[model samples]
Every structure is written in structure tokens, then in C-alpha cells.
Target chain A: MSKAWTFGENMNTDEIIPGRYNITIDPLELAKNVFCEVKPEYVKNAQPGDVIVGGQNFGCGSSREHAPIAIKGSLAKCVIAASFARIFFRNAVNIGLPILECPEAAVGISEGDDVEVNLSTGEIINRTNGRRYQANPLPDFVLKIADAGGIVNFLKMHDIQEVLA
Target chain B: MGTLIEEIFSRRAGGTVQAGEIVLLDVDYIMSHDNTTPLAIKAFREIGKPILDKNKIVLHLDHAYPAPNILAAENHRKILDFVKEQQLPHLFQQGVCHQVMLEEGFVTPGSIIIGADSHSNTYGAMGAFGTGLGSTEIGVAWVTGKCWFKVPETIRVELSGHTQPGVYAKDVMIHIAGLLGMDGGTYRSVEFGGEYIDNLPMHERIIFPNMSTEIGAKCGLIAADDVTIAYLENETPAKGPFERIVPANPRYERVLEIDVSLLAPQVACHPDVDNVKPLMAVEGLEVHEVYIGTCTNARYEDLEIVANILKGRKVNPLTRVIVTPASARIYKKALKNGLIEILIDAGCIVTGAGCGACIGRHGGILAPGERALTTMNRNFVGRMGSPLSEIYLASPATAAATALTGRITDPRGCL
Candidate 1:
């Protein structure tokens, strides 16, 4: 069971990861700086398995890879949003961050609600109401990589990294 | 199944690429700009190659030009350091990559163009297959002359009817983003056409593919017509035959059409592309800044429209309005046309053109609590330097109106 950190609609990458600190290459420093500019509390203290739910086009502007990398580093197991900007979605997947699209979730869930999400089945159960919703589970390929702790590890596990090398 | 541009670029992509389709594509033309080149040059050397073919590449210095950032200035130093070492010839002073390519007579129709910046789709307006890439991937491609692509499905966007005055291409793209919510065209190419698009001026038609990335499409395309030819002739070595591209008999997976005749001011509400609505519905929203420049809408023609509206008017002192042309050429033309004076006299600051305020890269950045109304693509949160500062995405006319009022407004004010 994971607690939902229900946020308002349209939580952008700057709210997730600010841009001023983009020049740095250190991932830990980046993780430390996540959302400190927009939501100061999150960067300083965010529990694991805490999912950030947002509105459409969550990531926009500047093709920065740091946006997704920082979010993943902060231990947001996944980001469930109503929709997403194209580049951010691709970057999230490419870097192995889990971003699921849940269009109606905006109206259904509430802040601080306890929920159970079965990643393999895409089943979301609201602990408060004991109601359940079908999550339209990710395809097998996504699950395989997500299970391997993101795509890079997936590539290493399946020996795909050898090809690029 | 067969997109006109894809059919022409990778002619061999169709038929069948099954469960395991490993294909090698001989990249036609590759491009790199200031920011990505230094790192790319490093990667290429590490990978062991001078470059597969010099002619197949274009090195642009557009990103950090005029106002060189620390990293890009370092890149410029490297470009100068290896000006002859790399044996490259596609270098130019930092300028807008899209306009520079067209003016220099680079990019031909049905050819593939890849650059480090995502908006490289600007060339797709000229009918070239252009897209963005990361530095490492570009460096590898420069050495190998090949890059792998998972063929994307195509979505046909049938645009018909004439636009109401001042409703230009940026409005049309915003309308599309509103219609097909952001993420609607994930991993797809938006093939554009219809009677409405056939007659737009060259600069106006250039806006479609420039911002397709807003809602997420690889590139946008339109069939070549007379307007394209007339514009091509003025440039260097005229382009080859006008490759007329026609939609398949049945047409795209999904067809969405917008009637420009009756459409009114539409705005992409703060934080999302699809948060769009008729302007009358959400008028009077407050804003802190208004920007009028981007690869999408900062051309000479676009500036001419704004200049007409701001001729004698003054922007609200409460609102910081900045207008950046897409290129130095457009800036010069604005000066020639007295558009620059109109902007200055009317309280608009016309700065050197190079993607100003669009990405908030260097020029003007807003504090967290501020809000900005812009004419460039994408109103995604934190897009214009402030995650807390809201951004309202609209047409140049609408942006100008907001500039005058310091609030989200319709440009029908001047009218």
C-alpha cells in the first residue's frame, strides 16, 4: 500500500525539478534540489513509493534530461498524470522513470489518500473508500524494464547494452 | 502505413518490420549547433572518427549566438579551436538554426535533417524531414553516418477554410493542441493539408511544424504549392523539383479539421496545451509579462502584424513585454519597415532575435510568482522561467492585447 501525494493539476517539471541548477552534473545534488524552488518541502523530505499525480503536459520547455532524472532520484516510484508533454514523457521512459496516464484519476482521488497499486495488473484500490479502478496496466515490455529498475538496467539484464557498445 | 515524407526519406521502411526489425538508415543530412558540438566533438573523438562525410553534416552556431552563454562560448572556442581541425564548413555566427538553414540554401525537400535542438522541425516547413536529438546520439551518427529509428505512425491533420484576420498559424497550432489534448499524437507524425493551408504565405505556413512538439508530434508537413516555390527561388541555389505530396486516398488514422472562419481567440490556459478555450470564455486573466518571439511566430511577417497593432499604442508599464524576432534578418527588415520604431515608441523592447523568452534561456526570466503570456508554442508549467509564475499561451494578437493591458486579453482591443 502506498500513500498518494495528491497535487493540484498542472504540476510542471520546474515544480518537480527547477532549471537554475541544470548546469550541475551531480545526480545527488540534483536530487537534493528537486522541487525546492517550487515546492521546498518535497526535495528536503519525500518518502519512497510516494506517487505525484498531476494534470496534462506535466513536462514542457527545454529538452533537459535532468527533469526526469531528478524525479526518479527523489524516489517518486511513478508519476500518474492526466496527460503529459511529449518530450517529458519520452525522456521519462528513456531514463526509466515510471509515468502512467490516468485521465479520470484527477476527479477520483484525494490528497493523503491511502491506495494500493498493483503495477503488474494496473489495479488501483482506494483504501479510504474501498473502491477500485482498473489502471490499464502497462504493456509487458514496460513492466519488464520497470521491474528491472528502469530501462538502463533492463538493457544490461538482457544484454542489449552489449549491442550499443 | 506510408507517410509521404517517411516514404521519401527511408523509402524502405514500409512492407514489414516485424517483431525484430533491425534496420540501418543512411542518414542523409546531419546538423549540430554550438551547445551540442563541443560535447559531440568529444564523443566523436572518443568513438574514433573524423566524420563519415563532411558534406552530409551542418554545424550551426545558433543556440548561444549574439549572447553567448558560458557553455556555448566554450563551444565557440572549441569550434574556433577545431575550425580547420575537424575540416568542417557549416559554421556560422550564432543565429536561429531554422532560418539560417533556409537562407544558406541548405535543407532540400524529402531530405532528412537532424539537429541537437528539438525545434529542428522548423525545416519540415520547407518539406525536409527534420527532428531533434541528444548530443551523444548526434555524435555517434556523425561518425557512423547512420541512426536507428522506430518508424512512427502518421496522423493526418486536415486543415480547411480561411483564418479570420490576425488568426495566423500559431493560432491554428494552438487550436489543434486544444482539440487533440496534449499527448494525443504521441509517437506520431502530423501530416498537414487541406484547401485552407494550400494558399498561406511561406512564413505563415512555417508555423505548423515548428510547434507540433507542443502536443507531441515528430514533425508536420504540407504539400508543396506555388507559395513555397516563390519563396525558394529568392534563396541560394534554388531547390530541385517541387515534390507535390498528396494524402492517400483514405487519409490519416484520425482526421481533425478546424474551421478558421468562425474561430475566435483561443488560449492554452496556464499549465497545459489542451486547457484551450475561446478567448471570450477566459478573458481578463492577469499576466506579468508578454513575449512575442520564437521559431514558431517571430518571423518578419509575424512582427509586421504586431507592429500594426502596436503602431501608436504603449504596452502597460505593469507588464514587461519583450519582442524578439526569430533572426537578425527579420530584425533588420523590421528596422527597414520601421516596425522596430513602432515597437520602441509603443513601449515594446525588440531585442536581438534568438529564441528569447521562449525557453527563458538567457534573455528575460520571470520570478516564481509572476505570470507571462507568450506567442511561442507550449504553455506547459514552468515553461517561461517560473513554475509558480503562470504562462498563458496564445496568438501574437492575443499576446499583444495582454501586453497592452497587463492581463490576458483579446487583441480585438485595437479593432
Candidate 2:
């Protein structure tokens, strides 16, 4: 089980990692500052396999993949949101950071609640409350990419031309 | 039968596909800037492949150009070294990546372009299927020249009626943001059509798509028409031949009809782009700085609007006004037309053409507790500097007018 970190609606990329720190592309360095402003203790307190739960339109601003990179670098297992912005969703998938769209899990999961998720089955269980929820499973191709550990790994296994064809 | 995005995707997919279908298609151009290129380069190295087509890749050093710190300098050096190593032909240090892409003729109608920046949707103004991707995706595209996309359902925004004298495209977009909320067009393609969009100049038309990200849209497109062609001919003579695209029987998931005939100047208040209100609601709120630039509204025409508002007038002594042209080309044009002089004479600090101040990497960062009024998009918390500072989004006219009063004043009142 993992701890849940909850955030309100429209949590933007800037809030995830301020643009000032964008000078560095190092994920670990970026991770140290993740949620520094909004949740000052996030980087220090968030443990491996912690799940971030957010309200609607989570990750709504800038296309900085650094946001997801920061979250993943922090060793968070996955992000669960009521809904996600398009680019953020793509960024997370491209980087192999698991994310789910389950409104019930987003609202029902309380901060510091013990949570468990199954990316393949789209199942989220709030161990604290004994409630389970279902998320829309990712498409097969996207799951394939995620399973391979991101688009780069997926590309290594399959020829680009063949993939397009 | 299909929306504009569906048509573009069909051509690339080589088959008729609907909104929910996924297709892998070859991309025409891939762009990345200082903020994203280093990460993309790292991913590209991890992929262990040579660039598939050096000609199709474009890079810029705009986000924190002229290196504000040692890390930025190192990143710039890395991008430069990679560009040299790959013999890439499209490295541009001249301006913001998006504006430079258009000025350099990379964005063509009915083409598919992806960038490592969200505002890549800005290319949709020319009727291209432009969307943003992560640096890793850009790295993958560098090796493969192709990416996958799920054709998005269409949100048809039919804009009618004429904007009032001081009302501008920025206001129209802010109004749309107000109506749609932040995620109104999430995972969808928003196509702006009808009389209002048809009548906007090229510079103005670009604002719609540029700010589309504010509404969580995948892309915001305008069908290629005579206005688009005319702008292309005038601005990008070397651009390749392209066909104008318009959906014959486009299907839409939802339709929003907005009449701008009597619209007032609008502002997106602090911390949220969707938290919009008419100028009257936030009038007289003091601002410490007034910024007029960004891909959203920093075109030469937008500068001209600021010039017209500031001509023979002076900015409030207490307010600091910073104006950045979107590109060096725009800076030169403004210089040639004496807009630069007008801005300077009005006490505005004119910065180099780049993404300066907008991303808060360097120029004009706000101090703690300070408030700013800018013509840029995205007023999210800490967007400009201190987390406690505030950013209010408005038009160039409103920015200039506010610069004169050091407060949020309606441009119409000044006019």
C-alpha cells in the first residue's frame, strides 16, 4: 500500500515544479523541488510508491514533462486524478509514469490514506476506507509503451516504420 | 463527414478515421527549445539512434536565452554541441520557437507539426495539426520522425459579431476561457470559425490557438482560408506548396456560439486563466508592472496596438512596463515603423525577442507580494516569479492603458 497526496482542481505544472528550476533537466534535481511551493513537505515526506490524488484538470498548464519526471523521480508509483489535461496525460505516458482517471478514487482517497493501484486492471482500492474504484484502462498500444518502460524502450523493440505501418 | 482534425489525420493515416481512432503518422517538423531540448537530447542519446532526418528537426535557445545562469549556459552549450554533431540545419537562436517557426515557414496548412512546448498549438492558426508532446516524445520523433495521436473530438466554437473598439482577440479568448472553464476542451480539438474569426488579422488569429492550452485543449485550429493563404504568401515565401483545408461535413461534439459585437475588455485574474471577468470588475486594481509580450500577443501588430495607446503619452512613473517582441523580425519591423521608439519614449523597457519574462526564467521577475498585469497567457501561481506575486492577463491595449495608470484600467476609457 502507498500513501495518498491530495490536491485540488487545476493543479498546474508550475505548481508541480516552478519554472525557475527549469534550468536543469536532471530529474532527481527537479524532484527535490517538486511541490515545494504548494506542499513544502512533499519532496521530503513523500515515500516510494506514494500515489498523488488530484481533482479535475490536474496538470493543466505548461507542457514541461519535468513535472511528471519530478513526480516519478520522487518515486511516486502513480498519479490518480479526476481528469487530466491532454498534454500532461501524454507526457506521463511518454515517460512511463502511470496515471489513472478515476473520479471516485480522486475524491474518496484522503490525504495520507493507504492506497493500492493496479495499472493493468485500472483498480484503485482505498485501504483506509476499504472502498474500491475502477479507472478507464489505457489503450493497448499505450499500455504496451508503459509496459516497455516508455516510448523510447518501446521504439527500441519495434522499428518505427513498422510501428507506423 | 469529419471534423478538420479528422481530415488532417485521415490524410496522414492514409485512411478515413474518426475522433476516437488512434493512428501513427509521420510528422513534418519537430521543434524544441532551451527549456526542453536538453532533456530531449538526453532521451535521444538513451534511444541510441542517429537523427532520422536532420532537416525536419528544429531547435531554439529562447526560454532563457543569453544564459541567465551556469546551468542554462551548460544546456545551451549541450544543444549547440548536439546541433553541430548532428549537422542540424534548423538551429535558431533568433526568437521564441513558435514565432520563429512561423516566420521561417515551418508551419504550413494541413501539415502535422509537434513541439516540446504546449503552445505548439499556436501553429493551428495556419490550419496545421500541431500539438505539444513531452521531451521524450520529441526525442522519439527525432529518431523515428513519427508519433501516434488519437484524433480528438471537435469543439466547434462559432464566433460571430464584431468586437468593440478596445476589445481585442485576447479579450475574446479570455471570454471563451470564462465560458468553457479550464478543462472545457480537454482532450479535444477546438476549431474557431464564423465571422469573428474570419475577420481577425493573421497576428490576431494566432492568439486563439496559442491560448488554447489555457482551456486544456489538444489543439485549437482554424480552417485554412484566403486570409491564411494571404498571410503565408506575405510572410513565408519559401514555404512549400500546401492545400487549404476545410471540413466538408464536419461533425462536432458540442457547439458554442459567442457573439462578440458588444464584448468588453476582459481579464483573467490572479492564479487562474479561467477565472475571467470583464475589465469593469477588476478596474483600478494597482499593478506594479505591466508586460506586453509573449507568443500569445507579442506580434508586431500587438506592439502597434500598444504604440497607438502609448503614443505621445507616458507610462506611470510608479509602474514598470516591459515590452518584448515575439521575434527579432517583429522587433526589426517595430523599429522600422517607429513603434520601438514610441514604446521607449513612453518609458517602456524593450527587451530582446524571446520568451523573456513570460516564463519568469529571467527578465522582469516579480517580487514577493507584487502584482503584475501582462498581455501574456497563463496567470497561474508563481508563473512570473514569487509564489506570493500575482499575474493578471489582459490585451496589449489594456496593458498599455494600465501602464499609464499603474492600475487595471479599461482600455475603452483611455480611448
Candidate 3:
């Protein structure tokens, strides 16, 4: 249960992880720079478990996974937007970031509001407003990937080790 | 109990995918622009592995031609350094990756391709599941042949009727995006078809897939056809496997139609490709910049449209316009056609043929609180340089018109 960190709708990847750092490869390095290019001071003042709620077309622009990795690396638990870009959404999941599509939820969740997300039930509860949004639940297979810390690691974790006799 | 959609799902689907689900993916293509190469080169060494496939890799220089910024010039040097060292197959000394890939041949339909730059989905026009990626994921994908993907559901867009005098494919896309809202198509595929789409010029139909990502679709496409064959043979030649793949009319779960005959002038409001309205509705909004570049609409024909508009008149002093061709070849052709001179004589700045404003790598960025009407794609916040800047998406005609008036003006009146 954490207070939600809110932003206006349509918060893009460039706003979430600006282009000045598109060159960097380290996820941790990206985390430090997340929103810094756009907001300049987002990471310095941001707390862990904050949620970025946005409006339509959130995470639009280069299908870069860094957009999500940077946000997740910064320790933000989830990003709830009215909608998510296809590539951005895919990249976020591929990197083990949480993105919730709560079209109506953003209308109610203001900045500095508190919200808790239940991974199992796909529920996001707003503490200040006593509001609840039922987010679209994730696919079972994708959950395994995220649970195992993204796809690359998830593949490593689920190694069945073929025993050829 | 399941149908074709569920079948495409079963092939890659596992676990639960829902609105709140943030799942990991396997990458197919990893692409990079001029700036990211130096760092990507450094990280590749840290990964400590030989490139898995050089042929699959693409290294392009789309930003800063004649060199825009010092950093871009330095980046160009780094890209040349690494591309030569690795013996990469897909290196573009002149064109943007989007045009070069479709021309020189790197994107294979059905393969998932990622780039270090945004708008890599330009390849989706050729039917590849291409998109942008970060330097890290790109570096890793270079080492390992495997990438991740979670099957995304598809949204079908059907187009009907024929084009009116001035409407083009870009307008059609912008018009739809405006209606659907930016996020409406988020996380879906736009499968295009209908009477008009079926007969569109292969090069023209490309505008659909190229700008699909702007409206949030992963890849916008019309199933490959005879027209595609004609274009591929003309653009990319060699004995390769390419078959005409058409989507079954009834198999498409959702269908949308656009009667080109009935459409009018359109514009994507500042900062959002989907914030669209009739161009007439937003008329009179002043513009200080008009950019006629980027992978989405910087095609050769796109240049011709601009040249035609500015042939006889000078641009408005208050408005600064830049036109970057998609490739060196297009540059030469425009020069041959005398379109380049028309642009320059009219005070339109012409840069090298790489992606300029479209990639935000260089050229045509707005100052804080500045406004622009452009023919490029993706007008998100801080996209062009200043976070407070505003951008409106439109056709080359509209862009040229605005360039003449120094604000959002209808192209129909100027000519």
C-alpha cells in the first residue's frame, strides 16, 4: 500500500525516459536518468512505489524498451495510464515493469494520492479518494515472465534441462 | 472454442495478458541511430560476445547530416568505426534506416525487428514486426539471436472508396488517429484493407505502416500483394523469398473503413498525433516552424509536394521550414527534378537525407512555447527539443502552407 504518484495524461516515453540518454545501455544507469531529461529533477525527488498515471497514447515514440526499464529501474511499482502504446506496453512487460490501463482511474487519482495494486486481483485502490479500479489482468504466461524478472531471465529460470539418453 | 485470433494467441500466448499486465517480450530486430552507436559499441564489448548475426543488424546515420550538432558529428564517427569493425551488412552512410531497410533489404516480414531509434516500425510497412529498442536490449539482442515478444491483439482498419484531389494516405492515417484518440489503438495491430487500400500504390500504401506507430499501433499494414511485389522488386532486388500474403476478409475480427472520397483536410493537434480535427476547425493557429522531414512522410513524392507549393513564392519570414529527404537517392532525384532549388530559393532549409526532426536527432526543433506544423510523425511532449514546444501533424501541403503563412494554414489556398 503506497501513495500514488500522478502525472497528466499522455505521458510519453520521452517524458518518462528522454532521448538524451537513448545511448545508455545499463538499466540502473537508465533508472538514474528516468524523467530527468524531461523533468530534470524527477529521479532526485521521486520515491519508490510511485505510480505514473497518464491519458491516451502514453509511452508513444520509439519502441524502445528503455522507456519502461528506466521507469521500473527507478523503483516505481506501476504505471497506470488511460491506455498504453503497443510497443511501449510490450517493452514494459518484456522488462518486468508494471503498466496498468485504467481509463477512468486516472480521472480520480490526483497527484500525491495513495494507491495500492494487487497483482493477483488486478485491483488498484486509491487511499485518499477511496476509489477502486479493476485493471485488465495479465496473461498467465506473461505473469511468469514478469515474476521471473523479465523474459530473458524468465527463460533462464524455467530451464528444463533436456536429458538425452 | 477459439478462432484465428486465439490461434495466433496460442502460438505465443502464455500466462495472463490483461490491461494491467506488464509482460516481458523477445525482440526480433535491434536497430540504432547515429548517436547511440558509440555507446552501443562500448556496451557490446562489455557483453563480451561476438555478434550473433551481422546481417540481422542495422547501423544507420539519420541524424545530423553535414552534421547538425557536435555530438552528432562525433556519433557519426563512432558509427563508422563500429560498422566497419564488425563488418555489419546493413550500414547506411546516407539514408535513414526506415527507407534504407525497406530499400537495401534488412526487414523480413513476420520477423520482429527492434532499433535503437524510434519509428523503427517504418519496416512494418513491409510486413515486419519492427519497432524501436534501447541500447541495452539492442546490445543484448546483438549477442543473442533470441528476443522476446508477447502476442498483441490486432485491431483491423478497413479503407473503402477512392482518394479525392488532394487527400493522401498520411491524411487518412492522421484522420483515423484523430478520431480514435492517441491511446485508442494502443497495444494493437492495425490491419488495413478495403476498396481504396486494395488498389493503392505500393509506395503510397507504405505511409499507413510508417505512421501506424504514431497512433500507438505496433505495425500498420495491408497484407502483402502484387503492388508490394512491384515495389520490392524495384526497391530491393535479389533472389529472396517473398509471397503475397493477404488477410482473409472474414477472418479479421474488427474492421474499419475510410472512404477516401469523403475525407477533407486534417491535422493532428499539437503534442498528440491522435488529437485530430478537421484542418478547417483549427485554422488560424499560428505556426513558427514547418518541418517536411522524418521517415514517416519524407519520401521523394513528399518532397515533390513541397516543391510544388513553394515553386513561385517565398516562405513567410517568421516561419522557419526544413526539409530532409529520406535518402541520398531521393536527394539526387529531387535535385534532378529541380525540387531542391525550389525549396532553397523559397527559403526552405534542406538538410541531408537522414531522419532529422522525425528522430529529433537534429534540425527543426521548436523553442520553448514555440509551435510548428509538420509532415513528420510522433508529436509527443519534448519530442522536438523544448518540452514546452508544440507540434501539429499534417500533410506536406498543409506544412508548406503553414510555412508560407507562419501559422497553421490550409494548403489549398496558397497554391
Highest lDDT: give the candidate number.
2
TM-score of each: 0.80, 0.98, 0.84
Q: Compared with the true structure, what per-residue lDDT tens digits does model 2 show for residues A24-143?
A: 777899999999999998888888999999999999888899999999989999999999988889889889999999998899999999998988899999999999999987877777
Q: Select the stronger candidate by DockQ from 1 and 3.
A: 3
lDDT of 3 by residue, B28-134 (tens): 45778766566556646655678877876777776656566665677777778787788887777787777877777665444467776656757666655665555
TM-score of chain A of each: 0.79, 0.95, 0.85
Who wins the TM-score comparison? 2
Off by over 4 Å in 3: A21-33, A36-44, A54-57, A80-83, A98-109, A115-137, A152-165, B1-30, B35-50, B64-85, B107-112, B116-118, B132-137, B148-151, B238-241, B359-361
TM-score of predicted chain B, candidate 2:
0.99
| Candidate structures ordered by TM-score, highest first | 2, 3, 1
Candidate 3 per-residue lDDT, tens place, A99-152, comes to 787788877888778888876677989888888889877666657656766545
Which regions in candidate 2 have their CA more than 4 angstroms from the true location? Answer: A161-165
Q: Which runs of model 1 end up more than 4 angstroms from their true locations?
A: A1-16, A24-29, A37-42, A46-62, A68-165, B9-23, B32-49, B61-85, B236-238, B413-415
Which of the CAPRI classes, incorrect, acceptable, medium or high, describes model 1?
incorrect
> Residue A94: error of model 1 in Å?
6.4
Residue A20 deviation, candidate 2, in Å?
A: 0.8
